[model samples]
Structure formats: C-alpha cells, structure tokens
Target: MIEQEQVLDALRAVYDPEIPINVVDLGLIYGVEITADGDVTVRMTMTAPQCPMSGYLLQQAEQGVRTVAGVRNVKVDLVFDPPWEPSMIKEDALKSAGILTDTPANPVEGDCSTEK
Candidate 1:
C-alpha cells in the first residue's frame, strides 16, 4: 500500500528552482491523498500565480510523488484560492534562508520584510 509519509518523503526531494529550500519546506504542498489502489493526489500552490517556473515545478512535484514505490497513479492539482504567503514556509526553512522574523497579528500590516 502507498503511504502518505513515503509520498511526502519523495516530494521533499523536489525543490523550487528559484528557492534554496525544497518544496515541502517551502510549504508549497497543501495536501496529499493516497488511495487504496495506490493512486496519489496532491494539492499545491506556487509562490506566485505568475511564476515562470510554475509548469516545471508542478511537473517536478508530480514526478517526485510518482517516485514512491507503490504510487501507481499521480495527480497534481494547482490551486490559488487561498494563495501563498511568506508565513506558509516552514519555520526552520525560513530561518535557514534568513527570512524568519516576527509576524504581526495582522500579517497584512506588513511587518514581514523580504530581502530582495
């Protein structure tokens, strides 16, 4: 049977071309679902809807999930409803990238700063 952890482990190998961190640490992956028959479905979003590497990144993610031994089928879904934010990134990843900082109660207030 396909396991979600294995799928996630596989996905951790995928990295965004523009970022130093892997997709998992970047929080690009929203969810992963594996069926009894070994089919896998992944819900994810890109850092930006207009990102030039979106197609390549999605392809990489799909290929990564397919690397799991028991995954017979793989599906990657791109969603933008909730959107991606700096806060979505894992704390460790952010810290490693030197982007971690205190987040304001109202994120929209712009307390977070990005280093060009």
Candidate 2:
C-alpha cells in the first residue's frame, strides 16, 4: 500500500511556475485520498481562477504522484469551492518565502478582526 506521506513527498516535487514554493507549501493541495487498490486522488486548487498555467500544473501534479511506488493511478481534481488564499500557506513556508505579512495579501472584504 502506498502511504500518504509518499504521495505528499511526490507533490513536493511539483511547483507552481509563478511561485518558487511547491504546491503543498503553497496550500494549493486541499486533500489526498488513497484507495485500497493503490489509486490516488488529490483535490487541489489554483492561486487564481484564470491562471494560465493551471493545466500545466495539474498535469505535473498527476504525473508526479503517478511516479510513486504502488500507485496504480493518479487523479487530480481541481476545485474552487473554498478558494485559495495566502493565509492558507504553511507558516514555515510563509516565513521561508519571505511573504509572511501582518495581514493576508488578499483579505476578504469587510473582514475585521482585532485579535493580535
């Protein structure tokens, strides 16, 4: 059986062309499911709705995961239900990328919170 960690490791090999960070670190990967039959399904989203490199990114993700041992098939599903935001990026990655800010780069409108 293939482990989720292996799948994630493979994902770390793939990256968004626009950004230097990998998909996992960027928080583009939402969830990962591995079937008993060794099939892997990854739910992910793009940084933007109209990203020109979205297709290329998806193909890279699928191909990357497919290379993992014991993975019979790989499926990457693009979703936008919850949307992607800078706040979703891992804290460590944010600090490493030097993009960590006091507030989100794309904060929601009318969002007000004073809990610092």
Candidate 3:
C-alpha cells in the first residue's frame, strides 16, 4: 500500500521552474489522497493562476508522485479557491530563496532587506 507521506516525499523532488523552492515547501500542494488500489490524487495550486509553467508543473507533479512505489496512478487537481500568498512559503525555503522579508527596525525608515 502507498502512503501519503511517501507521495509527499516524491513530490518534494519537484520544483517550480522559476522558484528555487520545491512545490511542497512553496505550499503549492494543498492535499494528498491515496486510494486502497494505490491510486494517488494531489490537490494543488500555483503561485499565480496565469503562470506559464502551470501545465509543466502539473506534469512534473504527476510524474513525481508516480515514482513512488505502489502508486499505480497519479492525478493532480489544480485549485485556486484560497489562493497562494508569500506567507504560505515554508520559512526555510523562503530564507533560502531570499524571499522572506524581515521587519524593519523603523517602519518609517523603510529599511527592509531581502537578505537574511
């Protein structure tokens, strides 16, 4: 039987072409469902609805999940109900990508820097 964690681990190997972080860390993956017959379904969304890499990313996610042992089939569903925000990004991934902005010492000074 395939486990959800196994499928997630496989998905961690997939990254957005324009982003340094993987889909999991980017919080693009919303949910994972595994059937008794080893079929896997992934619910996910992109950083932007009009993202050019949408199709490519979906294909990558499907292929990535299919690599998991016992995963007979993989399905990826794209959703945008909640939408994606910068805050959804994992702390580690954000830091690594120099995307997490730190609070400025003085709000009026506007001294925010992207570098951690």
lDDT of each: 0.87, 0.91, 0.90
Task: At residue 3, give the lDDT of candidate 3.
Answer: 81
Residues 1-116 of candidate 3: C-alpha lDDT, one tens digit per residue: 88888988999999998999999999999999999999999999999999999999999999999889888888899999799997998998887888765754444444455334
Off by over 4 Å in 1: 98-116
Clashes of each: 0, 0, 0
TM-score, prediction 3: 0.84
The model with the greater TM-score, 2 or 3, is: 3
TM-score of each: 0.82, 0.82, 0.84
Query: lDDT score of model 3?
Result: 0.90
C-alpha lDDT of residue 77 in model 1: 97
Model 3 Cα displacement at 77 (Å)? 0.5
lDDT of 1 by residue, 28-109 (tens): 8999988999999999999999999999999999999888897888999999868999888899987687666565544444
**Reference-based TM-score, model 1:** 0.82
What CA RMSD would you report for each candidate?
Answer: 6.7, 6.4, 4.6
Please give the lDDT score for candidate 2: 0.91
Of candidates 3 and 1, the better by TM-score: 3
